[model samples]
Target: MSEAPLAARPPAQQDPLPAAWPDHLRALPALIEAAGLVSFDFFDTLFIRPLADAEDAFDILGESRGIADFRARRRAAQAGAFRVMQQEKRGEIDLDGIYRCFDGLPDAAAVRDAEYALEQEITLPNPEMIAVFRAALAQGKPVVVTSDMYLRAPWFTALMRRHGLPEVPLFISADRDCTKRDFGALFDLLSAETGVPKERILHIGDNAASDIGKARERGLVAFHYREPRLPPRCKGISPAASLARALIRNHQQEVPPGSLRELGFQKGGPAALGFLDWIAGAARRDGIEHILFVSRDGHILRRMAEQVRPEALPPSSYLLGSRVAFTLAAMTPANFESHLPFLLSGADGLSPAELLARIDVPAPGASVLRDLGLGPETRFRHDQPEPMRGLLKAWRWEILKIARRNRRGLLRHLLELGLRPGQRVALVDVGWNGTTQEAFVAALRGLMPLDVTGYYFCLADSEDARRRRALMPMESLVGPDSVSPGMLAAIHANRVAAEFFFSAPHDPVIGYRDDAGGVVAVEDPGRAPTDGIQAMARELEEGMLDFARHHTGWTRRLGLRADPLGLAMPLLEEMADGSWADHSGLRLVRNFDSWASSANHTMWLTDYAARP
Candidate 1:
């Protein structure tokens, strides 16, 4: 049977028109109240291509002969042909005939691939629309999606779960052996399943003919979404939602009562902050009173909030956004809620679970991983390699992935120079002349067994009271005052041997001066100290390469590895300070950027005993 004529329903007698909507668009909140199930388009309406620039595509996979030009033309043709196909489909044309018509287009295969790639590639959804979904669930409305494209159901369902959307039902034209314009089959199936009158339902979609016009042709109120750049096919459409939001704004209404306190609805944790901008906007529009943010990393939460409100976000908006606002006391699930209140009250320290619990709104104690049905190894799939001889293998993948040829060459230089195991070395890091003893101590701790020690002289304006104050915090909490440079110098002079000397990349080269005013040799007690330093430097150079090869895989996998050789090249150049004279036993391996670059702070060497 043909679909019931939506136009047959008698129109409601008009009530005195209130202030017309700003520019006649219905508010989103008002639209939801006026209807039951709202339909939406999936692709462009809900999700968007993350790469805005056309060149971004070519940049990702590298250049190919004629690839860029081919891609541009193919996209243009596919879009034009798709539009024609859409019109024909609305007139009930056969799908196979439509496909055959497009088969003759120039670069038809390329066009098809581009269209498929839109689905195959990763997509980021509009955060604002997701908030609308959550708001609908909060109102106890039944939600379903209808789509023209043959999208994988589980994938979209997982996408919904990932974005903090409640798990709900869905419908697709492909599943029903139908297409977008086949409203008769779709509406009949939905009406029978939901048992809601067709008039009570409202459809909102970006498509003009298939979605808005067809739904309007039936008895239901259909709205044209008019949102820019909506994808061709989608099911969950709600044009009324935007109008509803505006209505809520115009009425200055409180959010539907008990929305926040509703069952199975709580705060989100780490992932929640990922969508802060979306949540904050929805909360503001819905008049949400409080928002709670929970995360193991307070720093991340702070960053999220900073991004969302920047200048205006306070703690009491629709959501509570914080580091650990839930269960802070317990390590396990059994004791989680027991300690939740104390943690929220700041009486307990933050725990990891509490952090996650505060952010998640899933069924309470619901294993979010299991609820979404993701595999345990999903996160590690990209990093793990096939087993070799029954043991996990981590090949050196990181260094090889470096984009710049110069950077890779520099890394090679440093690897050739690093200190090997069982070798002694002396390392010195330069900072302010007399400011940070902490830096010296840290260097000593990190560069262990290498006889590494930082050297700095005392500040000129030293005082006893200040020196004592500095020492007091460490020993007696009331003992000495702040430390003075003179006190430090005195302590060092008495305890440290004069044979030891400080090295500085920026310092003037001082040693024994020859008759020509050129430096000859460093005079010391039997020259043993200088000889030892040189010996250590030599071993460091020889062992560098082997260590990098063995450890590259581990470092890259953990994101803790750096190409010391690569990072070192720039650093060595900086330390040279424009003096490029060849040293007998040492070569500039890498010159890492200084703190000024905010990238890495390292300068490396290839040989300590010989100059290259």
Candidate 2:
């Protein structure tokens, strides 16, 4: 294949040209002028890893090949190989020699070959450093590349050529049988062979001890390359997470303004990826039989899961679910008080009729309120539990009839949907209080003996969720002690964004319907998405899935098993109420009546929105 010119390539993929010397290298030009020979460290300085660690190569190999603990095994093999080579007084340890120590291994050659392929695939050329290298050559100074890696000299040469590195001398440890660390070993050979005095040679690399300290001791001037990395955008982020943000920044260069794909790729993708991986691992660990991603948030989640979920993890199915469907279906006249907290979520300090209307009450509604001795506009506050309980009592029969009908249909829906009695299942959702999970529990009570667990993206009011811990096995990505209070706050503050991004482009489910062939989710047409929100949602979901697939591809190719949640925080934080991001399309998203209860009023996520 022919190479695309950097100028014509997407900004994200284009490397910096020779004119790209920045502040860090302001001193380099003078150093290059003074030196007769410029020696660059090959791995960190020239070839770079998108992954966080070198051992990750072994981990990826193990996962792909189905080998157990290959990282540890590979490390042990290298150590053993080095020790044996030292005892034998052979030259420096090399790749072939290391594999020889991997005893009793079938397809050792394949493993070795796979590792080599991974090493090459994972490493990319450092654009800025490549520019510095070209500048050194342009100045007519002799140059060479040095590396202490165990790969073959020819392989290294080919890698250099492919990356457009000048075909200069190589002082590789495996090839030269001496390393830069071996007290004056490779340096002595380099100085003598190149006929450049040690005082006039300049060495540059990332390792402070080896590249700077050791080289200066050998009478060569050294520059600690200090290879650049994106800083942690949020607290407790990993290097891999930081790199994820860097990847997004690179991606945004070409992305259009208000691109839903960028938003999903930046925030939603990582969130789903992390949450899905966490739940998949948890399901596998807990021996879960199947996972039901509760709708409509699960609409996007179910699609993203296939990209990152472990094969050993149980299969997943999407449950046509909603707060209204689950909560209302599971309600009873006697337990109306039990479900009052959820039903009255949008009714704090509001009219009693407001709650009834949200739950869809019919005949005698206005007149029934009068007969019950409570007017239509009667005030009800969250603090007035007594009044609320009294109101629920007056309308118990009317509500119970609807609840029972909803319950019957919802139960039939589940049974027809392939979930039966006695199955170990997990309920996955973009969570707050594990409400749907609990509702599923209540709806299935007496009908089925299924074991159900709940996995949420986050938990709100952790203390409240903890209070119900005795009732169900529930887990969250950002909840309780798992994350700092600050992170939890950020997550809570951005609930609207979370809901908007993950929500399916459909109406909210009020209950299930028994159609001729199967049970279909009955949606509240009143709560249906507007054409604008629906269109944006479709694009958002498309972008989110796009990100999932691209992320899977990039991470797998680089042998990085990324922390999806930690990596997601940077973009999520930027999208928060007050951050650097413009939040153009996001600002147009309407705030929801929590759980689709109460009045379905729409409020734009603009100045009226809450802030952290």
Candidate 3:
């Protein structure tokens, strides 16, 4: 019988230090200071073991005679035993107890040799991870290690300590025989030990069900540790990133800007009513006899106006208990302003003093210098003497005040044209949906009651038509094919008896055509609606209603369905007796146009230029 000799093995190659560590990661002290507590995980997440030998290696090697050769077999045996132990874990066997049981085995050296051999083959620290923990320590971040293992506390602690992570706090489920996945156990332990708010505690681990997901579900921000050997499905799909993004989205939702309720308007019906009250109060305070509220979309406003009961009326001109005397006239701002001078002139006769007398107003204050009448051009300099200067200043102020009053009176006279309570008024808008309609309705409802006895018809686009399909089933259902801008306008004029309309301006069915004869379509996805004025006005006129008053005259509130200024300029030009200038208020409100129409012309030119 012959004995075999041992072969010499080459020295192991050492890993080189990384050229440069990430500075951001290196500056973890600030983060640690910010974070009250830090936590970690163990096992495959923090440490990974190498490949194993056959299933029965350990038992086979246990029968080997010599220690040197047995060492190699022991390594193989250790891996086999670890595999068996892991498999036993699934079958309800305690891995730690198994390891301890092996500790008490008869061939202790063989087992020890097996463990050492396995350790040499498989065990190593993850370098980047080493950097992370070390950086955290430098930043004064307290470390806590949590694991869902069936290992003894002493053994786990000893294992981590051996792996350069001893300073970190260790919270092992098996240590207390309480798993981290058990929410009550983890919550109780975290609350009792850390005394930190549950929200402040961040649990980082690999398992979604047991670690990050459960922790996050309990209002804690969970940080899932990504490991390299993870399957592609698991990569970057941790609940941590999802939770963070969801939190941001939720925050954004909670603080959405420009909502009517957020703007101090009451929610629902009360908001509509309150808006009317606000508008009335503002009109009264401003002494504005004629208040024109032009909307590109006027559905809700028109509804409210039509629905006003007599009891909702404010009594005195601009003052009664619940009623206000201010007349509500809605047209495109351009049209309104064009006729503004005449309207103001008409309102010149509306005496603020008369209105004040109707309501109970306190007496005016007495003048200190009563009889000094000065000319309009009388001047006073800053360098004038005190007493005489004061008198001259007073006289000068009186003259200036009178001039200003007269100027305002002229403006009022011009603006007061056809301005009277109980006068025929209309609110024009661009679209049927959104806040503008809501706001206009509230304002109008405050003024006059509506007539619901009239017939109802809706001139809508494909989108709106689709939404209203259930209501208009038997009617000629026009899809994209039959619907056009002129067709929709005609529909509003002929079918709805709509006094006011609201619709999208860029909607091809209602949008304005420019000078070179091009319809304004939103071809550029990059562009946003600058303003909805003309569009709103056009929608109000075209999409909303066709009104036939007792006078046998048809009035349409046409929204320019363009930008406010864009819509305004064209209406102004049209008012000057040009080709588009046709202001017969009895038939149509105004033509809404756009400054941005040129962009459409440019696109047309570019198209022609690019032709083959």
**Segments of candidate 1 deviating more than 4 angstroms:** 1-26, 50-122, 150-152, 182-185, 228-612
Ranking by lDDT: 2, 3, 1
lDDT of 2 by residue, 1-612 (tens): 222121211222234334546667778888988998888998768767654455655766786787877877888999999999899986688899999999677899999998888777767776677767777766667788877778867877777767766467778888888878767477777888888899999999888777788888989989988654523234334434644554543243334436776777666777777777788778878889888888788888777766544463577888886778777787876677777677666565456755665565553466767766667657666776666667777777887777777787877877766787888898888878777787778878766778998888878766667776767898877776666777576667667667777788776677765678877776654432443766778887877776667666776655565575676565456545445224777666653333333333555645333466
TM-score of each model, in listed order = 0.28, 0.62, 0.26
Worst lDDT run of 10 residues, candidate 1, spans 261-270
In terms of lDDT, the best-performing candidate is: 2
Candidate 3 C-alpha RMSD relative to the actual structure: 28.4
Better of 1 and 3 by TM-score: 1
Tens-place lDDT per residue, model 3, 1-612, is 111111111221333224464442343334344656655666545554311212222322333333334434444544555567566653222343444444335666555555434343333354545545555444444556667754445655555557645345566665554566756366447646767666766565668787777777776666666543221221221121111111111112232233321111101122222233333443344344343333222233334434442222332121110001111122222333332232222121222222112212221223432333322222222342232233424433332333233233322332333345453332222222212233223333434432211011122444554554343221221213334555454333322122222222332221111224322211111112333334434433321121111000100111101111211121222222222211122133222222112211221111111110
Comparing 1 and 3 by lDDT, which wins? Answer: 3
lDDT score, residue 312, model 2?
30
- CA deviation > 4 Å runs, candidate 3: 1-34, 50-96, 99-121, 229-612
